[model samples]
Structures are given as structure tokens and as C-alpha cells.
Target: MKLVCTCIGCAIEASCPYSAPRFYLGEGQAWARHFTEDLTRENIVKGLKETNYGRCVYKSDNNVVDHQVVNMEFTGGATATFSMCGFTRHQERRIQIMGTKGEIRGEEGKIKVMDFVTHENTEIQIPEQTSGHGGGDSGIVRSFLKEVCGYNGSEGLTSASASVRSHLMAFAAEQSRLNNGQSIELDDFYKKLLVQV
Candidate 1:
């Protein structure tokens, strides 16, 4: 449920209640569209991407957050917190989940699931034989359309009803960030969406 990327950091750079840059491109920089043209050093240079790329990452953007902590409390009193920053060596996601009976932990490749009662630990070996990662997207779309999507048929990949929960959570997070990390009430936020829907 977490999306971490340069775009997230860039968003903070671009969006502040009062300090965001205007749509106009700053002088002597490549047009914004070129930023996503290609990652090759030559293309990146030509694109003249992100306005403040030449400046120190920490000092460039005006009001965006390079690092921040967000805390959330669910309706049933369960809680979650996440920390994000532009500084990291790895580009993949690692995750851990704890429950009353068992726990699951791992990154993209291998995950370990353990049962508290049985005391049995299982090791899942993921073999990609490339990228040193367990999984890669070689024929995922074909398999998906021929398999999962063939049955469900993209019913809710991006429908508003399917995405409302995540979208609302993101909105609340942004609101909380701007409000000095104040706690947000989900009920209050959801009600506002109801009116709009």
C-alpha cells in the first residue's frame, strides 16, 4: 500500500499550500516533458529534468519534504506508521506482517511464514536465476490476461470505487503532512468523499 519514488519526493517539492512553483518552466532548463524521455545520461541531460536537479537534493525544493514520518490509527484501533526519505541504497520493497497466529516477512523474492502454535518455520526459495531477485515480470501481463484477468476481466483495476480507499488514505496523509503531522479521523475524511461522489 506504499509507493516510494522520486515522484513522491518531487511531489513534496512541487506541492506546498503556498510555495509551489508555477506551471511555467524556469529559464535555461529543458522542457518538462523530456524528463521521462529516457534515463540515459545523454537524454537526462537533454531533458534538463527537474528544476533543482543541479542543486543539492536537500537544498533544492522549497517546501517539499525529503524525509517525513506519518502515523495512522484505524477505526478498530489498529495502527500503522511509515517513514520515507530520498536516501536509500535499495530500490525494492521489504515488508513484514504480524498477526495473532503467525507472521510473514520478506522482500520481493522470498518470504518466510511462521506459525506460533505449530512452531514450524518454512523457507520459500524463489529462483529467478537473474537480477538476484525471486520474481521478475517476463510474461506477467500475458499470464494475467490469460489467467486472472481472463476471468475477472479488469473489472476494477482503476475504477473509482475500487480505488477510493487508497485515494482517500493518500489525501489524508498529505493533509496530515501539511498540518504538522496532526492525526486525521477517517470517518470525517470519508464523509467528505461521500458528498463528492
Candidate 2:
């Protein structure tokens, strides 16, 4: 039995994504917390490539101590595990843009754009009113149509720089998590995007 287990471990080590062998043999809390940082689709994919573990494990034999131990402690823990296993039910999609002129919050089928300079807040309503994505899709479509057709009467909230800044936040959050929750300097990221220019 020991020989078979050793062989399995050796095979896993050869194929594991991490630089070190025995990925699960270390502190579980630290690893779990690390996984929560960044927590984006791309980073999650990278993490999975390095650590391949089953999202769900069932105990088929009464004599298997490992299975029993896992079954006893694994209930709500399946969400993250399943997420790592390429079983994501939905993609997280949000767009919030803040500028000296105003701010825009977009999700689902609604988009609220606020202009701090002019002290004006505008809410774009979606006709479909879908529950998914917080009504962002419809709002986006409406805004796009109005802008493209010159019917909005004013400029849209999102632009190339604003989009880049929003995405940079996600990247910074991931970097901070990997660095033990140390704050990531946003200046470099912003400079890369040339946001000020």
C-alpha cells in the first residue's frame, strides 16, 4: 500500500504546477487565503494549473481513513475547490469608472453615471430588465446605441483610460494577495496604461 501511494505521489509531483512537490502538505489556511486574493478568472486558471485537486470527493469505502476525514470536514469548502476545478458557474463582471469629471457604475441592465463637476446624475434604464449581471448588458447596449447614433446629447462615461484603470484594480488586488496582502503600488500600473496622458 505504501509503495502504491508513493508511486501516486511521485506522478503528481512530476505533473504538479508549483515549483515544489507535495503541494497539499503545507499550511492549508495560508494557501486558502492566498487563493482568495486577486481571485480573477485568469489568476484562478494559473493557480489551477499549479494545483490540481478535486472539487468534490466521496467516500466509497468505510476503511479509507483519508476519505472519512475529508467527508467530515468538507461541506461549504467545495465552492473554492470547484472553482479551481474549471467549474465556474458564472463570470464576475463589474465596471466602475471614477474620474475628476464624474463616475459610472455599470452592471446587469443599469448604468448610473454621475458628474461631480456638473452635479448631475443620470440613470440609464434597460428595457429588458433581466436579473442576470445586475442589468448591465441592457444598459451597456442602450448607452452604446445612443452614443453611436448621437442621441445621448452628452459624452459617455467609459473610455480607454477608464477601462484600463478599472481592470488595473483587479490586477493590483491579485498582486497584493500573492505578496501576503501587501498593498500594491498603483502608480506603476497607471503609468503602464498612460492614464494621465
Candidate 3:
């Protein structure tokens, strides 16, 4: 079974809202696609250090079998509950764009555009009934396919740049938590990545 959530902090083992795992847990290319851009060794080390799982019982011996059993216990017990585990931070971001003609707000795959001048509001129903992350998968795929086929340029429910920005925001939040909740500049973080590339 596959489960998907905005972050690991939002997962509930007993009654998971998203069908996919809290984090990307699949193997092979499927797993690689979601994290390809941020799969640097430095990022891995940083995530590990921030989580502090090094001191947990799961790392006692470093043997594969022992580690797997211990890790399962650690991740499955009550201690792994969303509110108890503090390794990952939870966040829901809403982007609002105000144009002279109208305004657009998007979050969780739903988008609403309201025209202030005409007092008219339009709600877009994301096509495809997805059970993961409130239909984010459907919205993402539709937007990507539209762009790939050159049907539209930047007019879609969500663009690639927007998705990248959201991912970067999550990454920045993780960095902030690791640095004792210091404020992270999103633009600077994105700029740094571009420099690296």
C-alpha cells in the first residue's frame, strides 16, 4: 500500500488520512523522482543530525536485522505518534495571488479565484479522485501534463515552479528547526541551490 502526506508529522498510523506513507518510502526510480533534487550527501547528513536518531535504540548495533526490528518498534510505537515525534515539522502553506482582475488562493490541491470587481468566486474541482494528500497527485499530474503537451504555458492549477517553491519551503522549515528555529529566508535558500547547480 502507498500513502502520501505533506510531512511525516501529519501521519497517523491507526487512521491515516493519506493512503501513502508519511514520507517517500518506495524503492527504485519512483522514490528517486520525488527527492532527486535534494538527495545530496550533505542534506542526508543534515537530516540525520537534526532528527537525532543516532542516539535512539534503533542505532545500537548498526546490524541490518537488529536495526530493522528496532527501527520498526521505534516508528510504530506510541512514541512515534504525530504529536510525540518532533523530528519533522508540520506546515500547510496557502499561496494567494492578487491580480487586478481577480485573486487566486491555492492549497492542498484546491484553488479558488475570486473577482473583487464582479464579486464572483470560482472554485476549481481538481480532476481525478485521489486519496493522497487531498488530491495533490491529481492536480500535480494534470498541471504537468498540460505543460508537457504545450497546451498552456503558465496557466494551470499549479505550475512546476510553484511545486518547487513548496518543496523548498519544507526544506527550509527543516533547516530552521535544525538551527534552533532560526528564520530561514526562502529566496536566499533557492538562490543558494541555483548557485550550486
The best candidate by TM-score is 1
lDDT of 2 by residue, 1-197 (tens): 31112212244555554422233334322343344465454554355444433121221122322211001112343211111122233334456766668889876667899999889899997565444445556666676777787755555644456667668766665565566657555777567557656
In Å, residue 172's CA in model 2 sits off its true spot by 0.8
Better of 1 and 3 by TM-score: 1
| CA lDDT of each prediction against the hidden true structure | 0.57, 0.48, 0.50
Per-residue accuracy of model 3 over 68-167 as CA lDDT, tens digit each:
1011112233221112232323434466666668889886557899998999988986554534455567767777787788874456657666768668
Query: By TM-score, how accurate is candidate 2?
Result: 0.33
Tens-digit per-residue lDDT, 71-127, candidate 1: 777767776766677555344556677788998887667879999999888879666
Q: Report the CA-based lDDT of candidate 1 relative to the real structure.
A: 0.57
Name the lDDT of candidate 3: 0.50
Model 1 Cα shift for residue 177 (angstroms): 1.8
Candidate 1 vs candidate 2: the lDDT winner is 1
Q: What's the residue-level lDDT of 55 in candidate 2? A: 21
Query: Between prediction 2 and prediction 3, which has the larger TM-score?
Result: 3
Question: Candidate 1's error at 129, in angstroms?
Answer: 11
Error of 1 at 98 (Å): 0.6
